[model samples]
Target: MQSVAEFDNVGLRYGTDAETLSDISFKLFPGSFYFLTGPSGAGKTSLLKLLYLAHRPSRGAIHMFGQDIVTMPRARLPGFRRRIGVVFQDFRLVPHLSAFDNIALPLRIAGIAERDLLGPVGEMLSWIGLTERADARPATLSGGEQQRVAIARAVIGRPELLVADEPTGNVDPDMAVRLLQLFAALNRLGTTVVVATHDIHLLQEIEGAQMVRLDKGRLSDPTGSLKYPPRPLVLRS
Candidate 1:
């Protein structure tokens, strides 16, 4: 199977005294569903930030789409980012933009035709049960609604990889399950999914999932079913 992303002995330090992530290594395969769980301040956010190219590793290498991200040109980062979609913890929607515009941003950025944008954007909004609220601003929507809108926007382009940070944090349990099912559906269609969350009870109920637990900036394969050796610990400077 082709690998979508790999972290090789990656470590991250925010400042002189803090080690955000240490000795971290993992390979996310194409069409895989992964749940990243850990306590708060355990580097889950940092890991997601690294995965999204928000921050580079303090040491070691991160390979995405067959290239070393650390060595990639800064001018090309945005193009690389377009290949992956991110649903942030904050639901970073443009408050001034309507839900439609917000979800259409990716396509618009790519210079997609105006005629072609409505189909995918509308379908995604409907899939998330937000078709009725498509004209509303983010500030007017409920937390769960905003979360769903954020998700719609992320998967609107059907990215090769989807990285969601604390995706279900604001959603009710029933809706959380629903959202997870949405992700599962996307994975079935061949998009690699990596979700960072601390919702153990919710994730454990997901069958056939590859659960990666991070503790003290270290990673583990909970099922131990993979033939590959365990990912090594990433050390912080």
Candidate 2:
């Protein structure tokens, strides 16, 4: 099976600054789960930006869904981005839109009919335990609620690849585990999941999740297993 994404000798720099990411290389296979862990300035967010097509690398190649994204025309990025879901650490919900609308945004952007959105959107609202708060705007929701909304929004589209930056940072431990389980469930359904987090305890929540660590803008895998084919996750009963 074709890998969902591959990076070859990737490096990224901002303006005249030294590279924020250097010599990064990895492959993310379909249906696999990955955790990107590193210190605060380890370039995890920068790497994720590249993964979700938010920024093009200053050097090296990035291929997603079998296409070279670095050289792909900027005009076509929106179409490619539709195939990936991103959950930003800031929650980035539209202030003017209610939680339901925020979760429904992707489907609307995909041009799904208005009549067809109620079912999926409603289900997602329920899944996040926010069905009663569906009409509440981001400002009205608590941090954890907003985070849950963001997660629901990211996964509601069921994109082929899901990239999240510090998804569990704001929640309590229980909610964090619940969110991880949500991602695990999505992974079980064949969506490639990549989560960048500082919480080491969450690493064991999903069996067979490959770990990729970054420090001072460099990649390192002590186990040397990240570059190999993904292992199947053994879900606990």
* TM value for model 2: 0.97
Instruction: Report the C-alpha lDDT of model 2 over 1-237, residue by residue, as the tens digit.
Output: 688999999999999999999999888889999999999999999999999999999999999999999999999999989999999999999999999999999999999999999999999899889999999999999999999999999999999999999999998888888888888889989999999999988887877888989999999986565668778885442
Model 1: per-residue lDDT, tens digit, 1-237?
557788988999987856778888778877777788888887888898998899999998999977789999999899889989899999999999999999999999989999999998989888888899899999999999999889888988888899999999999987788888878777878888889988878666567666788888877767652334323211111
Off by over 4 Å in 2: 235-237
User: What 10-residue stretch in candidate 2 is worst by lDDT?
Assistant: 228-237
Worst 10 residues of 1 by lDDT: 228-237
Cα TM-score per model: 0.92, 0.97
Error of 1 at 86 (Å): 0.6
Model 2 error, position 118 (Å): 0.6
Pairs in steric clash, model 2: none
